[model samples]
Target: MTSVSQRPAPTPRQLTRTSDRLSFIYLERCTVHREANAITAQDAEGTTHIPSATIGTLLLGPGTRVTHQAMSVLGETGAAVCWVGEHGVRYYASGRALSRSSALMEAQARQWANPRQRLAVARDMYRMRFPDEDPTSLTRQELLGREGRRVKDCYRAQAARTGVPWRGRRYSPGDFTAGDTVNQSITAAAQCMYGIAHAVVTSLACSPALGFVHSGHELSFVLDIADLYKTEIGIPLAFDIAAESDEDPGPRTRRALRDRINEISLLNRCVDDIKRLLIPEATARAAAETDRDVVTLQTDGGHHIASGINYDDHENATW
Candidate 1:
């Protein structure tokens, strides 16, 4: 006689709400503390509790101090940590990806390893920026040259639209004061893009080192993905902010970019674009599996997390 059996349902963890999944938290001069499931920032004024579940990435800006306990909690929450500088934001470190599977990363590596596939991916990216045109036959150098020309034109157009002075894009990594307000604004906008790109890439369990367009850097893929949206959003955003009065453009630019990001629902768009670019077939399968709710949930000390990198929103996603 055959017997029928049913598996027990997975228990949901009692994690805190993220309050609409606010993506970025920029802090300075405030000490970070973790109590229970909440993260807080303390200063002379008072204490501000940051909801860890909704925090995508925490920026440790200048003059901020963080304790080991706080770091431990953030790791558990699966939040990405970035150490920042003036012009550009370099990724200092991060916790483990919410997804436990490396299938997406492996697929990325496979495509990146093949020269033809790499070029094809590059063409796909170019097409993303220039959807009306075809770039399938273009060589890598030709593609790069065309992209550069498009960016120059984009800068000029945005400058004209926003009434900002065009003094060319000049930026020295170490020299923060190297350019005008426009330059500063552009730098701030680009930094935000890079951070978002890093978050999405890591969240998908992909390696930022295996880049199709850029190479030989830790954030090569970050640069590649971030550059894809430069014309569509970043350039116009910087130009608009630069058009504002010339006082303190850095914070203003980042805040405005954040607003635009929210307005256009950019996070979900990013996840979709990354899936479309990396592994379409596998992504489709994952989406199907997720729809069927066949995911494997893992519990680390009774804290539940989704088991694989996601195409759609993860069921037990950490953050």
Candidate 2:
């Protein structure tokens, strides 16, 4: 019997999340209907066509009814669907992210499986939140305490800056009218942050349930990633909008968040941060690959192949 040569594995498709297609649209009280290759929102104001190809995330807040066809189109275009409550209090569910790559997911699991390695990853995330504080020697509880103090300080600082009366963070899930203006604004901005964070996390092919700091919940990882930006993006915007005393803070906060995100290039930053925070081994592995000596083959136009596999560039096979 003749021996069989192994067939090469087919290249995995790329679900590229573009930097240009980064608008995290927030919609409420509208009907999302699929209109032939496009998505549109039908409400009292009339039909407004949405550019689905470039939409990163669509926050379907209260009263937003999305048709099955619209969801199918969104899934096809790789746009994340986030179902949130009014003022973003209830993060009920989210649709799938577009990435088909499993490399990052495997790396994240391997790291978390080991006790020492898991702690190291946690410290790395903590460092991102507190660059000044050395997380190298801190335990998990210590990190939690520090983060708690930091969040309190952020609320106080923002309240002082905006001159908004702050009683504290008090809210019942799905009860948007229960909280004061400041609380409502904070909740609104935070929902936007969570929605954007989910898009970035899913784009990287990371697990939302596997988180370093926040754990044991569906949105554990989403919350962990979102917290990294509370001081910089979330709290500041809430304070600014509340300070303005806008007659309608909910819509205004959402608009301001979208603008602020674009202005600061927050989507790109979120994507980069997720990779750096979760799969740092990728950097080291890349360095190791570059350090190895490449072997040249006379066939295939004198192909010079590296020594290891690169999931990011599967077509340029190495291993």
Candidate 3:
């Protein structure tokens, strides 16, 4: 009988490297085609080329299609491509290479349901990122001051002009009634925030479900992040756009909302603050290993796990 010497587990540094290698390819307005078993893409610049095999997730907007050749190429590349249409609809196709990651994702799905754990994780994240700030302190008064009040007033006046319900207070997910104009506006805003948060999470190589503060439910972190904006940015902006015209918001409204959100410096700052807090803790958890086992655990954030991981290096790297 041959005895096996155990291999050393991967360090935290290795896990971070894996995460950095992950990339998200978002096709906001591009065309994909396949012909005779070759895949090609045409972008706004009129440039045509084949996508890199390294691309992990390929997201397409409405009306995007996969041709026979393109499908073959994608199949060979073993990437997961997602097509998103109007009203939050989605379709996806995955290749064989994604099987391993997909399995790891399933393992992750099992650990997301405890709210207390999520809050603890959120506190840890806050402590890690904002060591100087007190978690119990609500800075709404100091932060909002007079300027925040003005923005709120502006939002209310705009809402009134559109004949929409002016709640005269901050909006919450539970506030919207079903099938009303206000409800539609709320849903749209929430959806936009969801998309933005998803994009941000993908960009940061973090898992959206296994989140701090929001817990293990699907879309929890998204809900948390969206909550941060729905009242501050989304509500005001939605009202403003509606006030501009009595017409229903179509593509123009979508474009306007996107542009307005993009222009808000404060919104970007808030997201940056949240990201800085969340990523390190998740990374540290990812690098931990048990005993001598060199098990590779897949996290929602797409991090790999090894044994006895030290978070010091990962923390240092972020700084």
Q: Best candidate per TM-score, number? A: 1
Clashing pairs in 3: 34-70, 112-216, 207-300, 207-301, 289-306, 289-307, 289-308
lDDT per model, in order?
0.76, 0.76, 0.47
Better of 2 and 3 by lDDT: 2
Ranking by lDDT: 2, 1, 3
Residues 145-174, model 3: lDDT tens digits: 433554466566666667666654433443
Q: TM-scores of the models, in the given order?
A: 0.83, 0.81, 0.47
User: What digit string (tens of lDDT, one per residue) describes model 2 on residues 41-67?
Assistant: 999989999877678888888899998
Question: Residue 116 CA error for candidate 1 (Å)?
Answer: 0.8
Clash number for each model: 1, 0, 7
lDDT of 1: 0.76
The Cα error of candidate 1 at residue 22, in Å, is 2.2
Give me the runs in candidate 2 sitting further than 4 Å from their true place: 1-18, 284-319
Off by over 4 Å in 3: 1-31, 34-62, 67-82, 89-117, 120-163, 166-178, 213-216, 265-271, 279-319
Model 1 lDDT per residue over 260-293, tens place: 8878878777777777787766545674331232
Q: Candidate 1, 111: how far from true, in Å?
A: 0.5
